[model samples]
Target: MAIINCPFCNKKASDKSAVCGNCGGKLGEMSVEELDRLQRDKRLALGQSLNNHAMMSLIIFLGSFAWYYYREPETDSLEMYAIHGAMLVGCAWYLVTKVRLVLYKRK
Candidate 1:
């Protein structure tokens, strides 16, 4: 088989190989159109995930606050505090992922 450059790692690999030796990335099996379609689908999935995460973050933040104000007891329980903390963490994670996605697009 011919030697081909690995798309993921930029290393030389055999075209016969199913995966890149350097990075273990899938390789050389897909047609050009199939590869393009796969990449398009992957990007679309990522964008959908980002949107879902952002919406979930916003919903959690707003819902937690609304619950705290309207339904929580006069003195907050440990569970309520934990819920808020978890929401904050989730929101932070979503924001960080969003930033990473933006940086990846720039590259």
Candidate 2:
């Protein structure tokens, strides 16, 4: 195994090791370009995660509105309508955010 300096602790580390022995930080035989690409990929993944969360929130709000709509003894109440309207607004917000993030990823 080739010996290299650990980026985290500057200690001698073997290229074959997955982590630094001293600082327990990730140690890999990666070039500068590869490292930058890895970081970029991570940021993209984070953006994707945000999109997922937004979609989930939208689904939850829509489902709740559906459940409230179909419940038995449907008495027309202003409060019920208000609550459903709020849920719809929440769903719209999340949907917009998810779409924006997805479009941003394409660019």
Candidate 3:
């Protein structure tokens, strides 16, 4: 049997399954409109999750910025390097997530 993503819960299930293993949703009996609605809901949920991640990344970036300014870490020091790394990673992650959201919206 082939494994496939369930339209109801986006979980792995057998292509031969009549019901989804994760969500216990009837797979074979669902109508086209129902499947379309479920897919849209899944897309929306993913977008919202991505937005939450973007918000968290922004918060991390801001926190790191504030910490760096407050401490005034010495140049070439471990603390300075760590703070810079965090700031860079957080900013990059936020930007990537935003871009992904945009791409997803276009779909």
Q: Count the backbone clashes (under 3 Å) in each candidate.
A: 0, 0, 0
lDDT of each: 0.72, 0.72, 0.88
The positional error of residue 50 in candidate 1, measured at the CA in angstroms, is 1.2
Off by over 4 Å in 3: 1-26
Candidate 1 structure quality by residue, lDDT tens digits, 1-107: 77766656657878678888999988767655664565667667777887777777777777677766777645578868766786687678778767967875775
lDDT of each residue in 1-107, candidate 3, tens digit only = 77767896788877677899899989778755776688778888898999999999999999999999999999999999999999999999999999998998888
Q: What pairs collide in candidate 2?
A: none
Mark the regions of model 2 whose C-alpha exceeds 4 Å error after superposition. Answer: 1-23, 26-28, 72-107
TM-score-based ranking, best first?
3, 1, 2
The TM-scores, one per candidate, come to 0.61, 0.48, 0.75
